[model samples]
Structure formats: structure tokens, C-alpha cells
Target: MDATMENKMGLPPPYEPAAPNPAPPPSYFGDNPPPPPGFVAPPVAPRTTVITSATTRPGSTKLGPGPTGTTCATCNKSIVTRVEYVPNNRTHIVSAALCVLAGCCCGCIVPYCMRSCKTANHYCPQCKAFVGSHQPS
Candidate 1:
């Protein structure tokens, strides 16, 4: 009449303790076990390389005649400078004196028109900032 009596014949044999988990497998290291399979070591980060470079300071590098290449300080942009020539004061004075000595008033303007008698002013083409000047020696 009871449920236990009715199911006794269909039940599996009663449980028996499992052999104390078999002595764990031997490890290559003295006592530490190897990492479990499927464990990928954390990706080793690539070693960072330190690179040093020589830099030119704006003040240290003087601009030259023509379209000179340089970095602009105002805008901090690398560019080829646009050069504009203007008559040097010293050259003008000397030219005028030499012309008067030669007794020719029109000749005083000749040196002012010459490229070699002018000073070269360098400007950043991108920002139009004055970079430097090259005064003829």
C-alpha cells in the first residue's frame, strides 16, 4: 500500500563513497600544478620602446634668405617660409653717400633696387607670422 514498497524493485543500488579522489596527477613543478588546459596566458603586452630624437628650438635656428623651411612659433605649424626683401637702412645710407660723392643723384636709387642690398624677412606662409630676418653682413 506504501509508495516506498512499490518502488523498491526499480531503484538503483545504494550509494558507496567514491575512492578518495585518486591521488592528483603528478606535476612537473615540485608541488604546483600546471595551468588548466584552454587557459591562454594573458597576452603578454608588447614591450614599449623608448625613442629619443634631436629637436631644433625655434630661437636657436636662424632663418635664411629665400623661401626657408621652418616651424612657426605663433601657430606651431611646420612650413616653408615666404621671404620678402626690404631695403636695409645701412645700405640705403651708404648708397646715398657714395652716389653724392660720385656727383650723381639718380645713382643713389640703384642700390635700393638691388636684391643684395635688402634684408630678408621670413614669414610663415600658413599663418603669415613673422618668423625671422636675415640681415646682409
Candidate 2:
């Protein structure tokens, strides 16, 4: 017999009218309804907070020698950490902009020797310093 005709579940025929569903009571559940007996709300856990410290020398100036905590390599005195940057092209750009603005040469922008030599796995021809791996120009 076909599945539908078999009443495969041994249930009454599918076309048999289901018993009329009785109308549900107007409100099955409501706020502030009295608990039947032993119902109780679970306690809530407190929220947690996390924080991290993220700070470095401002504008990427390397911490180095001289009288004050911040010192200029050229003057051998503390000019200010705000402008002086490590001897790179960027430092030159910054000093050049400063020269244009203030009309003075603040200091020489040192060429990046460490990277050029380290990349070649040889001593720096100019500085004569041994270059190490992992050093970036």
C-alpha cells in the first residue's frame, strides 16, 4: 500500500478532520504573575574590564646620550625630542621641512648604514661596522 494510504503511523487517515482545537486562555503568561511554587531567578555575574599600556618615545626618536633625557646628536645638547628622529630619510625630510620653516639646518640626517650592509651580509664599507642579520636599513 502507498505510504499515505497505509496510515504508515497507524494514525487515522490524513483527511480525517482534527479534533477542533480549543481556544487558548487569553493570557498564557504575563509579567508579575505569581510563581506557581518554587520558581526563582538566577543571580547575575558582574561584568569584567581589561586595559593595556601602549606608549613609546613620541615621534619615534630613539632614547640616547647627552645632558637632558632628550638630546640632539648634532649640538650634543637636548634640543627637544619632538623634531629629532633617527638618522633616516624621514629625519632628513623632517629637518628639511624645519629648515624651510625656520630657515636653519638643525642637524645632519645620517644615512641608513646598518640595513644596506646587513642585507649584503658584509661589513659596512663606509662605517666599517660589522653588520648583523635581522638589522633593517
Candidate 3:
């Protein structure tokens, strides 16, 4: 191969250094700049709030009827009564069998009709921690 062919297959060309940045413009104001006339600053909302000894912070608590005297072990907050329907593993097999044997009506509708098919999962209202579950006997 020729010198030109060898150069083409060789390493890439050397990189060129970039030009130095131009000097920044001088500051018009020495330090603080005065606000324009009649330009009243927007009123800031007052931060005053009633301090409470309760460990539960505002916006941190869950929205629901909190169960009285029931303390959460996870977040140390009061537990609340919240019913969560979770799919039952045993019922899932039945549902799948019904789906295969019967049409969409029995398969899709039977599971929802059976309320006991799903396990009730109780969670903490504050931190959404899993408190306990109640399975249908």
C-alpha cells in the first residue's frame, strides 16, 4: 500500500486547542441594585404556625379514619382502618380453571362475585406500612 493509504488507515489527526474565552463585561452595580420605583415586592406568606409536641408531621399523615390506641411498629404512628383487596393465590388457580372451562362470563365475573376470594391487606395510613392481613377462613 502507498503512504497515503497507510496514513488513511493510521491514527486520526492531532486535535487543535480551542481559542481563549473573551473577558467578561464589568458589573454595572457595585453590590446591591435598588428596585425600580413602584415595583413593590410580592408579599411573602407568613411562616407562623402553631408548634405541637406530636411527632406526626403535617402532610406526612395518611388521609383516613385512624384507629385509636393502635400504634404502628414501623413508623411509630397510629394505625388506621383501611381495607385492601389482594388477589388470593388459591383463588387465582380456580379463576384460571374457570376461565379455561367456562366462557368469559364465569371466568371474568366469578372471581369478583366471590368477595372471600381476595385477602384483606391492612396497611398503616401514615407510612403505608403493612400492619397485618385478614384471610377468609
- Give the winner by lDDT: 1
Local error of candidate 1 at residue 4 (angstroms)? 99
For candidate 3, what's the RMSD?
13.6
Clashing pairs counted in every model: 0, 1, 0
In model 2, state the lDDT of residue 26: 69
Residue 6 in model 2: lDDT: 68
Decreasing lDDT order of the candidates:
1, 3, 2
Note the residue pairs that clash in candidate 3: none
lDDT of each: 0.79, 0.41, 0.65
For residues 84-112, what per-residue lDDT tens digits would candidate 2 score against the true structure? 12244554565567667766654322233
Tens-digit per-residue lDDT, 1-137, candidate 1:
45576578676555788897778876668877788999888888799999985464455467676777788877878888898999878777979897988898877878888767889888878888788888887
Displacement of the residue 44 alpha carbon in candidate 2, Å: 63
* TM-score of every prediction relative to native: 0.54, 0.18, 0.39
Tens-digit lDDT string for candidate 3 (30-98) = 687777898988899989888667555333433332332355667886555466776788678778888
- TM-score of predicted structure 1: 0.54
